[model samples]
Target: MTHAPSPASSDRFKSFSEFYPYYIHEHSNQICRRIHIVGSALVLVILATAIITRNAWWLLAMPVVGYGFAWVGHFVFEKNRPATFKYPLWSLMGDWRMFFETVSGKRRF
Candidate 1:
């Protein structure tokens, strides 16, 4: 298993491939990962609802619903600061990737 990067590490990842192991490491906690998966699933549901109903309001709640659940898991369960604060785009990508990986049985749920 790849060791998680230290919280104090100052290394800046140049690629998503390089960052993903660290992303997975950060979510080592089962409950935290489960929460994130739920959040991502809700995000997909909200997106489909918005598109199907032509209601843009649901779109506004995506980030709130997604980030809210994720933050709770990070602060309460993982007891670690989110990687999002430092790597917004990569973190978002990581969330979705992790979600799919978990759901597809590539990673433990």
Candidate 2:
């Protein structure tokens, strides 16, 4: 990812909203998007389980919730690096956004 990816160019991202298109472009595969969705769902489940069980250990699952499935997708399916390394917070937002987009039919698979 040392090479500049045309779609994720920093030139166009003056703000978070401006960066959204670039973020969307980074996720170009359906499997990658699905993996992200699963990871996010697992995150939510972990959060709920943590609150219900009152276990601090469940909070430790964030990395797995966030990175596990995404890493697998990157290595097995996309065969590319995750944008999370470049933008962690926005990468998260992008994942949820992509998930909702897929569910809402705003994104084509």
Candidate 3:
């Protein structure tokens, strides 16, 4: 089996684009992507509900609904550092892109 490449350096990322390959490298596991997909969808739903009902609670649920599943996937399946720890914004974008790639047959896993 091909092994996932270890991070070359822990040095700070200069930009989000620079961090994306490392982010994708960390998400080498199929289970991780699946969890991200579910979590992101839940986040969207929660945001939509918050918009509709104007409930502050739905906004508060973003982390629970988003990171909960994602963390589980990271800790249990991938056993790797999530890009969110460093590149929060890009990691969010990466999560959605990776989810779509997996769903649309662009990514094998």
> Can you write out model 2's per-residue Cα lDDT over 1-109, one digit (the tens) per residue?
3433343344444556765776766666678778877887788889999999999899999787679998887778877788787778877777888778877898776
* Candidate with best TM-score: 1
TM-score of each: 0.91, 0.78, 0.78
- Candidate 2: 10-residue stretch with minimal lDDT: 1-10
Task: Evaluate all candidate structures by whole-model CA lDDT and list the values in order.
Answer: 0.92, 0.76, 0.81
TM-score, cand. 3 vs. native? 0.78
**Candidate 1 wrongly placed segments (more than 4 Å):** 1-3, 6-10
Give, for candidate 1, the lowest lDDT window spanning 10 residues.
1-10
For candidate 2, the per-residue lDDT at 22 reads: 67
Model 3, 49: alpha-carbon shift in Å?
1.3
Q: What is the TM-score of candidate 1?
A: 0.91
lDDT of 3 by residue, 1-109 (tens): 8554344476666666666777788887888878888898889899999999998788989988789999999999999777788778988888888877877899875
lDDT of 1 by residue, 1-109 (tens): 6567644455688788888888889998999999999999999999999999999999999999999999999999999999999999999999999988889999999
Candidate 3: count the clashes: 0
Models ranked on lDDT: 1, 3, 2
